[model samples]
Target: MTNILFVCTGNTCRSPMAQAIMQHRSEWNVQSAGIFAGEGADASQGTKEVLHAKGIPFLHQSQPVTDSLLEWADLVLTMTQNHRDLLKQQYQAATNKIYALKEYIDPDYEQAWTELKEAYAQLEDQKLVGKEMQADVIRKINKLEKKVQNVDISDPFGGNIMTYQKTYEELDNYLAQLVKKMENENR
Candidate 1:
């Protein structure tokens, strides 16, 4: 079975919600953690209410990302590009299996995303040598940015029930896509 680890900032909102959604839809071993979560905290109330309304059962305790958890996950999907990048930087060995959720599922954005990563790396390298921003690279980044939709799953930590529901719907849609992709790969 595939082992998927969903990640976000605090673990009380997005990641747990993702874990519940995926668990409800598939038999895969699924879990979630946060980069900076405190241990043993309950999921946010809005998260609980939304999941309950959808009839998706969830039991979660916030935990910070750890080496053991990283090792357990066959695939680590993050809520945002920043979360993905942070995990990649911290665990270079596991970089191959880590991706932002949208980036992993959206083939249309793949080329644009790759070029943007390369362009950002080049820009950083130039900065280290005190060079001015290259016009071509700047142009490339701007163009690619327009092509790539925001890959972040919306955070609903302090939002009302409606807000949390919207976020849940967004996640549910992408996760449905994820299920199809996984099934296709296994075929």
Candidate 2:
């Protein structure tokens, strides 16, 4: 089975929602992790409620991203550009396999990549640290954000239930298209 990993900032929401929704398809081996998940964390109430709305029952304990997970994942889909950037920096070996979830689903993914990369290259450097790191990273992220935000699935942590619902519906729409495209390609 193809191993697919979904990642986000916290495992309590986006990635778990993706995992649960995709698990229903029975096509690939799917798992989810967070870049900075606290140990033994449960899925947020918003996530559970959203999944339940679509008749998906998901019980997940949050886990942090690991080398093992990087190795196992055939394709890694991240929730946002920030998550993608972290994965690329931390797991350079898996750079070829990592993509933003929207990047994977969007028709103009390559153009988006090109534009984002060009903007990133125009930025001073990739590795900024200490106090300067915050400003530099924000600048770099902001540049790419303008070109790709139209396709990005927004993070809904700590928002109202409606916010969570919007996030879930967007994810579900893209995921449905993703599964369809994968099936067609495989066939």
In order of appearance, the predictions have TM-scores of 0.85, 0.80
Number of backbone-clashing residue pairs for each candidate, in the order shown: 0, 0
Top candidate, metric TM-score: 1
Worst 10 residues of 2 by lDDT: 120-129
User: Would you list the C-alpha lDDT of every candidate in the order shown?
Assistant: 0.93, 0.85
Q: What CA RMSD would you report for each candidate?
A: 4.7, 7.6
Error of 1 at 165 (Å): 0.7
Q: Model 2 over residues 4-62: C-alpha lDDT tens digits?
A: 99999889989998999899766699999999987679899999988888788888999
Q: Which sections of candidate 2 miss by over 4 Å?
A: 112-145, 149-151
Q: What's the CA error at residue 39 for candidate 1, in Å? A: 0.8
The superposed Cα distance between candidate 2 and the true structure at residue 56, in angstroms, equals 0.6
